[model samples]
Target: MPYVITRLCTNDGACVEVCPVACIHTRPGAPQFYIDPDVCIDCEQCEIVCPVDAIFKDVDVPAEHAEAIDINASFFRQNKAVVGPVAFETAWQMVQRAHAYAASVGIAVTAAVVDEAGVPIAVGRMDGAAPRTAELAVSKAYTAAAFHLATADLAAQARQPWLRSLVVAHRGRLLPAAGGLVIFDGITIIGAVGVAGGSATDHDVLCCQAAFSVLETGGH
Candidate 1:
């Protein structure tokens, strides 16, 4: 069985840095980190390094932390896939790099980094960007993260009846605009980035692409 991170997890990131496969993840405000059953390699590194002793093999979880197995498992069940919630430092770097890229190209934009579940990890609005750009950026990131497809591809299908209905069902939180791209860590999806308020959708996409270089070069 895969290892599980219980409520005792402190999100201190000791285990995250130790895991060979990078399957441990938690957001900034999350109560604890979780291990992805789909991606974990069964290495006990997390359990070994976890300062709080929160990591446990599924079958070995103590009775006090037994519910943690379901909590950890159910988080992935709610998403199409949940390899990561993305480390906060990495998300921050992505947003900063995205905004820097947009500025370099003389464009004003809002950039957002969201986890696999489409929850915000980091966000930034360049100077002079429109206020509403923040919402669009987040929606675009959510579209890519929630569906595992870039907004460019999804926008083309937004005209179809089914796509239109899907957008509506989400109460318009899904943006089929061309500025979102999913991010990966060694073939495992970590999160997504979205950019908005650039000169054109293509400009937004270019900025989004540039931000990915941060991860490529640093593996952060």
Candidate 2:
């Protein structure tokens, strides 16, 4: 039987790096990763490396995540390519759409997009926004991608020593603030988006979540 990846996956890309056959991948719009049934060697390298313990043999998948078996197989049989940045066009367009959403809501915000590795792709700020808004935007995106969770959700764990060290190790670049989020396209991870403009008590998270709709629509 083949291996499977379930929703519990953090999309941390740990299993992807360890797969010998390179069969582990996330299809476009897939909320979590999937193991290609045909190419998986059943060598269990991924299972050993999975930090979330989300990978399992088709037969061994626990009852809670059992749906992954068919989800993984059907993904390989359906789509021809995994969703990546190329599908989202250039970074400029992405930023524009993010701000467009912000504009519609009468907010002056800055937006940033980062790859799965937490590298910045684009950062755009609207007029009347503080210059540092771009910094917050980028840091938020980085934090989200690195932790594989929305920054707001990470807030409760932000005070943990391990998480604090993680931030320090990343050159003090991560911000476990409200405006960052992981962007998922099905089981595959497209990347992350961050927006900042509103105050801590106001629309920061609202604007950040709105960016998801912008991203899902291909930023058009």
Choose the strongest candidate by lDDT.
1
What TM value does model 1 have?
0.62
Across 1-220, the per-residue lDDT of candidate 2 in tens digits comes to: 6788988998888999866446787856668888888556465778988887988898888999888888898877786556675234545666776677677777788988888777888778899788989898899988777656778876776786656766777788978778887776675456788888875524767666666665566563
- Quote the positional error of residue 54 for candidate 2 in Å: 16
The deviation in Å at residue 11 for candidate 1 is 44
lDDT of 2 at 190: 61
Superposition TM-score, candidate 2 onto the true structure: 0.58
Q: Write the per-residue lDDT of candidate 1 for residues 1-220, one digit (tens) a residue.
A: 7899989876788988866445777666879888878666465777887887888899899999899998987766665443557788888888888888888888899999998778889999988999999999999998887666688977766786656766787789888889999877655577889999998778999989888888888847
CA lDDT of each prediction against the hidden true structure? 0.82, 0.75
Superposed model 1: Cα runs more than 4 Å off = 1-83
Model 2 worst lDDT run, 10 consecutive residues: 85-94
